[model samples]
Target: MPAEQKSGAARALAELSDFSMKIARGQRMLDRVKDEHVQIATADKEIVFREDKTTLYRYKSTAERKVSVPVLVAYGQIGRYTMTDLQEDRSMLRNLLALGVDVYAVDWGSPSRSDRWLKFEDYVDVYLNDCIEFICREHGIEAINLLGICEGGVFSLCYAALNPERVKNLILTITPVDFHQDQAEGRVNHGLLNLWTRGMSDDDVDRLIEASGNLPGELTGYVFSQMTPGATLSKYNVGLLDTFDDEKKLLNFLRMEKWLADRPHHPGEAAKQLLINLYKNNEMIRGEFQLGERTVDLSDISMPVLNVYAKDDHIIPPKTTQALRDAVGTSDYQEIGLEGGHVGVFVSGKSQGVLAKGIVEWLSERDAPSARD
Candidate 1:
């Protein structure tokens, strides 16, 4: 071989060796991350109220409580509420606590065969209402702050609509209010959930619910994963490969993996209604959704609303959440569009500060002196 060619080949070999070393480092980091199995939602919390599968917990505060009305978080039934607190450094609840905000969360525990009959009415009017009342009575206040996530946002909207007097300021994060936007024309951004649920028939949903009693967590998890099938397929290996050399990033990734694996079974009645009425018919946004005997009118949500959503969220489209700004009855509605994906709304380091700061600023401004008295 020519002298120059030999030198080029040697350089190429050195480059390949460097990449191989990086991959090896990443593998070791992944092993450590897995073995650690870091526990999530690590902040100290006391279970303030319990109702069957539902448990409401108030996080023990380190900072003095600056806000009078404690913020109660209502999370989706599809996954663990711990997603908000996936890690200590990357936790949404911890950030709220650090901001001197009194934070509380409801754990919609995994349902059993006997919990098949749990409905939207049961969740909204019963369990959720009970939690709110508990907080209000504990604080000696008529109204408390309510923060709802995703499907829980639907419940919050309904709850605030029916019992507006109980919710001081409503905060909805990555909550999909306009279920029909995915089907609308000129919608450049849409989630696969809308596409999948639109095809589901009434009989199909009924039979599935009857057969399984509740929507199995695994099934729900699979559906969520399918939303980003390409990423789901490559996430474990590709993600670890990309971040394995960095212990911090790799460990955080594992924490997220554990949280994703902890899906909770959704109640059958609620699941059926969500599929049939909310997703398929898009009734919630149409002012036709009914919980028990009363209709859930979005206009009934008259409280000062803070709507937050991700710009690149594939799971919940921007239009889906942005719809609330105009649909709600309140003129005090404020919205901030941040750059992140669905889960990044809580987890991303850069995004968390933006999210936390926006929330604290908004809540502080609206926390009236009259509210405390």
Candidate 2:
């Protein structure tokens, strides 16, 4: 054979070897991995309170409690709270515990057709209020820190606004304040959901709820997947291929897939409010959003506020999250822009430390008596 042909043959052989090695690694993974081996949200915790479809948990920690006020992490119904505790090393909850911050989280359990009548008022005023009261009684503290993620941040905003005395410090992550701000600053790629929702009329939204009873998790998942179709396609192909040969990275990817597969159904009435009242009408920013009978005026949130947003967040644009700055009642409000996308703020190794450390320091500062005074 000529030199060029020999080099080509060698390259083809190298490719074949690489393919065979990947197949062997995949086989090994399939043979050894079990359901138990791919577990997530495995941090030790005890249920402190439970309602119809909501449960509040307090994580066990060996580190001495440094912040006097405990933090109650509230994530929205669209996604499970597992993202914060996706794995052992990458868990934001674990990071807080290690830093001596007493951590508690609420799990808005899976809602069914029977829960179609559930509204934002039920979540914010009734269930969330009960959780806060439970934490306050347990700690013998008048107020506990509130850390809200995504839709849960909206709940926290309403709760803190209605009962500011009960929340010592309010922290919002990837939460949209001005639902209409998606188009602001001329950023087109961000807030696909916002645009999608605005395009619908009130009748369309009502009809959707009437027909579906609840916003199905699978449908929402599909919409999100559509937002990044390229990533969705490459995720199973190129993304999975890259991790096929590495057990640790492969397991991490599987864990995230497990989390992604667990999106929860958003109750019908709440879904309507989310889509029409907030997203379409832009009520949250206008101070016209109604939770039960009372309006969720963002200005009512008078506690020390820390608004955290993903700098590259597409779902909730930085401008949307930052809108809270002018809307809130607190003069001590602060914003920390993390280096990641929406969920990346929680899972990405690069941004998780910045998130955890920022929370700890912010909470510690306001947690002190002098700072509070």
Q: List model 2 lDDT by residue over 1-373, tens digit each.
A: 9999999999999999998899788778868889998899999999989999899999998599888788999999999999999999899999999989999999999999999999999999999999999988877778889999999999999999989989989999999999988978787788899999999999998898888799999989999999998999899878988887788898899999999999899999999999998999989899899887898778888899999999889899999999999988889999999988999999998976788899999988877522222
Estimate, for each residue in 66-112, the C-alpha lDDT of model 1 and write its tens digit. Answer: 77678999998877789888888888899899989999999888888
Deviating ranges (above 4 Å) for candidate 1: 31-37, 183-189, 369-373
Report the Cα lDDT for residue 174, model 1: 89
**Candidate 2 TM-score over all chains jointly:** 0.96
Candidate 1 minimal-lDDT segment of 10 residues = 182-191
**What's the residue-level lDDT of 346 in candidate 1?**
89
